[model samples]
Target: MDPQLPAWRIAPEDDVAVALKPLETGETCLGVALRQPIPAGHKFALNALAEGSEVRRYRAPIGIATRPIAPGEHVHGHNLRTALSGELAYRFAAVAKATPVRDKGHRFDGYVRADGGVGTRNELWILPTVGCVGRLGERLAREAERRAGEALASGAIDGVHAFNHPFGCSQLGADLDGTAAVLAALAQNPNAGGVLLLGLGCESNQIDALMARIPADRHARIRAVRAQSEHDEFEAGLRAIGDLLAAMARDRRQPVPLSALRLGVKCGGSDAMSGLTANPLIGRMADAVTQAGGSAILTEIPEMFGAEKLLLERCENEDVFDRLTAMVNGFKRYFLAHGEPVSENPSPGNIAGGITTLEEKSLGAVQKGGVATVADVIGYGERTTRGGLTILEAPGNDAVSTTALAAAGATVTLFSTGRGTPLGSPVPTVKIASNAALATAKRNWIDFDAGTVLTDGIDAASDALLARIVAIASGERTRNETNDERAIGIWKRGVTL
Candidate 1:
């Protein structure tokens, strides 16, 4: 065995180990000679296996072998196939322990709302009740920003912004309700010190109905206008936003405990290095937040396929376990009902980055949740009511899930990526790159480099990352915020009519 080859076996029971660098035929690593060229971020079999044998990574079954695989052979999609199928019964084992609180006395400067919600950003938001007036809302926000230029300069307000989506009209049943709920949740988001709800008089998601969903205390900071009700819609919107700006100007930041922080953990465009570097680093941050008496949310249910057991066992109780199980199986049924398989993931980008199966992808993705005990399971568009690590029901789609995270009240989101994307949520979306190459290549998109974990050690990388997160919570702009890449996508589950 060559001691210098960069390879990692995640656990003692793992039969395959990941190659940290390219390996040529005949090169030896971990006592196995490579039978073929193995690319960096790909896996190599540590021992021979027959067809149909379980292929292990992360010390669990990732897939079944399609053909007889020799020791040292490259393991990838060409030979590995996912074994995930129909829903399986789950039993709570309570494997994870409570993360110990360190009481570091850490704090961040945040805006505290009247409802006692904390905000990392104090901005004015313009939410359109229908897609027909989305552009109008944007124009209104721009005009408000122009009028409130001096207030913005004086730190009385962060900025005037508008969120535009293609839904809100022509949606029925759950689709309409989902749109309304998400929009209302966004309106109540702590980051928005004040909000202006703009609407077209005839829409499924009416302004009045949306307002009814918002909490009473927030009404003082919220204003509404119906485009069809006003002769000059743009002028009316500008006037409403002017009032919102005046109220927002009264909001100010105060020293808030770390326990007030609600963090959203996400990953996208992941590569093999994702599991080894970035993901685990995020896990550490998750642990820190939970230990500090704060809350952290983990979503992207479909990506939790093979690794569901890991989280299910961490549930705080049987009820939480049952809810989590239902959430996992329910998503699987969603895929099957649509004539698709549960393992039909690990996108094209993922395969290129050496993720062979959904199981492999899942094991890596769940690391963002850390080792904290699961406290609650929240439905889509529902706000998080409990602290500690909570599981949220949402799709694995980048924009959709991140939007759900924001709606669930995450003031800041730590998004880990390996292949790279310019996607950002309405809140401050901190982009964590899995590799140094991607970090250097996309400096404008990446906010933190997890690749340093491979060289500097996880402890140092995690400490540095936590510091960066606290800085962001104190109103530092992430790369996404600086690049103006903010967007949102609501999950549509029913007929469009």
Candidate 2:
């Protein structure tokens, strides 16, 4: 997009151009004079469109015209509707593997764990087994912070945090399975030098079950407490923390290859500029890391709807393509089973930001994955076992999805936003604003301004972003960390019995 222009068309085949700024009635753009006012970030037809004609953006169908749209008229939700209905079938049509960027030997100062994984931050984590003991975990974390104040001041560890989610109890089957799986994965994150597995004894998400889910090798670094069984749970937790901190004090940062790094790509509160700027900018960064032999994970399954084919075709093999196909249709079935339309997306906020349909949102959202070959299809809460691009099964909720990314082994997340938000992930979330206005308005929240891409161009913007991510991996605090915006959200599905 050219900020210098009054309006910009994203692709050659696009039938509409998004207003670079609010366009008044009778303004001339794209060889057509505007018939009505168009809000900046909103779209205007490039040519006449008959009812039911496909609306193209990013060289793909975003939706179809619900009614006749005259040239230069506003193209938005009022005139457009999603063409998607339900599950889709995908045939494996392999695309050439995208070449990785030239390896420049990118490295970051990180803590090397006994398991050979490197950590961007060495922190103590307190995880509650069930919602019943959530506050207990928080209290333990606070007291530990006070006890470890000197060590914290001396940088022995990053910080102590308690991730308390309200589902472990009264949950059955898959619900309990997901809760335990995520808790176990979080404990195993290289960032958590030590973990306090706090539990309320009588929950379906039992401490024993969670412990079993965690690898035996990781148990040495984890301290589990049955709050109900302990005489003084707080004191028990404090003692456990004391022991863990003492052991972690020996951990120190050392230079490691970029291959040890895992990057998670995400976007939230998107607007029209998201696809044009922030997302593609993040894509370049993802490609850089992957090219250097590092790993990258992309989630938000619902947002992959219309763009599934783009990702599916890039799969490394028939197995991956088949798995991805199942995952996509399964998510769509999840919506239908709940009696909701699959295209019931583009939240009011998305619509206000000029997104007309789920197709438009998905097309923009997948740009974060770049052109990397699809390495694998990972289940919810499962960690990425190999490097390259892994597609994770997750919803589009800001917190839940990002938390899933962190659990899936992302040490740092490059989060893109157009509408802007203060939400952060368990890992450091580097917020990239889609426009200059947003970056300026949320200076404290935004870590990078991809809006520069409008003038500076993508290659220049991407170079800066990759450098910023490397610095973050080397222990530089992101805006999210400095603002104390770190949080975790667990997805709740299945019955609560």
| TM-score (C-alpha, index-matched) for candidate 1 | 0.98
- Pairs that clash in candidate 2: none
For model 2, residues 223-246, the per-residue Cα lDDT tens digits are: 999988999988998999999999
> Candidate 1 — worst ten consecutive residues by lDDT sum?
1-10
Itemize residue pairs with steric clashes in candidate 1. none
TM value for model 2: 0.98
Model 1 residue 447 distance off true place after TM-score fit, in angstroms: 0.4
Model 2, runs deviating above 4 Å: none
lDDT value for model 1:
0.90
**Model 2 poorest 10 in a row by lDDT:** 94-103
